[model samples]
Target: MRWAGRGTEPEAVERFYAVIPAGGIGSRLWPLSRADAPKFLHDLTGSGQTLLKETWDRLSPIAGDDRVMVVCGRAHRAAVEEQLPKLEDRNVVLESEGKDSSAAIGLAAAILEHREPGVIIGSFAADHVIGDQRRFRQAVVEAVAVADAGYIATIGILPSEPAIGFGYIEGGQKLDVPGTTAAYAVTRFVEKPDLATAREYVESGRYLWNGGMFIARADALLDEMAKTKPQLVAGLRRLAAAWDTPERGVVVDEEWPRLEKIAIDYSVAEPAAAAGRLAVVVGEFPWDDVGDFASIAKLQSGGRGSDLAILGEHARVLADSSSGIVVTDRDRLITLIGVENIVVVDTEDALLVTTSEHAQRVKSVVDALKLSGRTDVL
Candidate 1:
């Protein structure tokens, strides 16, 4: 974990860092994803392990347990530690408050740079699910190789559909990287588009869903931040300097609140792409961020019954002429009669009933709850 000079180690033997940014409430999941226990802490797929733990499992083989780091809020530090017991205490970077992804990932990059020069770091979200582990590892390996060549690399998931929920990356010329077969120069990063635009993007075959996975040398990432978000870079560098010292907590408490709240896309990736420093590796693996309840249903259904999906093990669902989705954490029997395209989420304290089409609007329920000052349920 000490700094060896740049180019001292071979590309294969060089250290690669995996940074997990675990700091979202997942409001679209509503009652299931709450303030104390977020979506990342739950096993949405009933896989027996939480999403955060699964993320760690996926990255530990590529980066090793010692090199993997998680940047999360101080409030959820205990939960993160509980879920990932094998994670070293020092590898968990705690933010005093939520300053968004730019601060989270930039601080992690700055700290990693301070620890070891010429280190490659990849930032992945804690709540995403990857179906093909082999393809995921392959994509990461290619991304790291591209990063080693002095470019900011990202894993661009091959779009299986015209999804308007996620952003898109337009790839330009194909790169001639040695290890990767489908590396491309990133032309631009576009936001989530309308239905017609998404259709056009998919039909054109030049676009990939932006999976939010970014890889780069720690020094390079910090340098990019220095150009676009100089003040954040300065603060992160200052905090990183004191990271291992006794004043770490004091410095973080003082500096973290003052940092600007911005996302890494706006702070670095977009600007860097415009400056011709971004590269992307095509990730053909099945990937989903599980943004809403409809996505969860799709994941659980296995495409067998698109009209009806059940999401819990103990949910004794009796559907008679009913079709849609039902999710229950309790052991009680759930009966649906003559219902169509409806969603029923039964928890101990909260019950959400809506249509499958309105699954994306669950966040509105959370907003109304907040407006009513119903912190007890929220």
Candidate 2:
């Protein structure tokens, strides 16, 4: 892997720790992604290994088998452990409840900082699909170099299209960090915009899709948390101080619930970017967050103009002059004759039938089910 530097400065080769926060329910990808068994537990890519396992495999080469940590919910602890057998019990940080990305990542960082003062920690999601492993690794290496220079570095994926679903990161002038090329100062972070704004951003070529991947020193991350969210930092510090002690469970149970529910993007990233304490490394690798069914269809179809796409094993799907996607977990044939641009998710207990255009609104269905007291399907 080639890396760009200012001069002949030696590359920062330190022990890197990868902290994966695997706590999302992925409500949009319902049926397949449920409360008891979230999306990360299933092999959405049909690669035999689950998404959590894939994440572990992807990071193992860089962080070593032992240095990689996972922060997940208490309910999914068994599943995470089953998928990642190499992960130590100590390395699997458990959250009492879902507090959001900030708490999950901050807790992991605090524990890592306590274990090793200067450990470089990179937070990558458990459900993201990353193509071109070499390019992804190259970007991570560069991000680590930028992080070593004491900036919270993020990998900003080069936008492939004007997608209104993902946020954007506006990049500023390039930084003078050594052993890096394409490291830029982050101008600002923008939320998911309308199609018109997204088109403008793509045409301007100054924005990158926010991939939610961040790399920085454990201490640096904790320090930023201290500044932006002092209460969160205090609680995490208390938990980290007791992480390996006998009172760990008691401390977490008492403190975790009181921590504010906030995302890392809002609690740290955006604030840090505003204060000129953030850097973005342009990542051109193919990446997808697999947010909804439409994204899954795109991945399965290989972005081809196929009228139909199927995701799952033993799915005897037969479509005639129809354009849609079908996912089946049952042992039966699914026939689509004339439906166009539809999405059919067939599970044992629940089957979801909706148009692909409404893929982003599947979360509403989840909410409706909750209101109707249909927790069995949820």
Candidate 3:
């Protein structure tokens, strides 16, 4: 049988170009995920592989060696290079100034456009955790089919809990597209709801947690930005116009300082979602944004009632810690005696202690430190 959009012909698997935005300094993880050591670099789940490495492994098969790109800040460039030295320096586009996701994704889009026209690009966050790789790849394949149909596709995580921290996508109407089983025509893009609203959404069964994973053709995304966010488009275009030139590439030292700072969600995704120009796939994988310490804890083996003994019972203990996190750099002897719903993070310079429920507000602490010019702790 032929695919829906391909019209009586078996649709080919779309060539994928992955763009990983690895530029954030995770303050929630505090001293562990500091400015010098970004969250993507840390062993998020006590696994040997870091978050960034896990993301790369998932995308490497789909995007191949040259097609995968990582966009990060200049400060973290060498570290990122050390992590993934196989990727060329040019492919690892660095922002001289720390702009948000908007400018970062725009730069990535422009670079990919120069390489492949109408290429399907997957924008994966550098700090997410997916439990099942097979299911994750299946979702990507489905999203690619949706993108090939001239739609900006985003994967919506199946919300197991009423998470007020995540934005919600209402998706009930299945789109009639090929190469996909459950692609939805997005009806509404809801902002992060309050606890009450989030509860309602969970009950309604019409919403999925905004996964922050997006897929679209490079040109399509740029076109949407041009229509919805003209100024942002203009700024990116000006920077991209000189992309191949020796002047810009040789001395981004000068060119990058000129680009504006904004997040891709504000610049592109939110606006496009508001304008009814986005598609959503209810991703069939166990997914977590890993935005906070608690989320990371849940993904690991010692989550709920599970004894994950890297050592003896006395050495490692995570018992009855609902909605909490416990991590220590001291591998010799680390144990949580009796704690419920708390974040315990011990690092070289700082030790963070906070309630698990207050995980979302952790970013504010990072913000406060930055406001006070505490880059040493950041």
Worst 10 residues of 2 by lDDT: 1-10
The residue pairs in collision within model 3 are 4-178, 101-264, 102-263, 102-264
lDDT of 3 by residue, 1-378 (tens): 212333322242446788999988777667668877888987676667888988888887666667788998878887787778677666788777787887788778877876677778889999888888777777887888888898889999888889877889987578888878888877777888999999999899889988888899888888886775676666676667667676566445555666667667766777777777788987767777777776775666544624332311223444543435567665444456565666776666777877667766788988888899987877
What is the RMSD, in Å, between candidate 2 and the native fold over all Cα?
2.7
lDDT of each: 0.88, 0.88, 0.75
Q: TM-score, each model? A: 0.94, 0.96, 0.87
Which ten residues in a row are the worst by lDDT in model 1?
1-10
Per-residue lDDT tens digits for candidate 2, residues 9-125, read 334545588999999989999988999989888777667778889888888777777888999988998888888888987899888889999899999999998988888899999
What TM-score does candidate 3 reach? 0.87
For model 1, state the Cα shift of residue 209 in Å: 0.6
User: Could you tell me the lDDT of residue 319 within candidate 2?
Assistant: 84
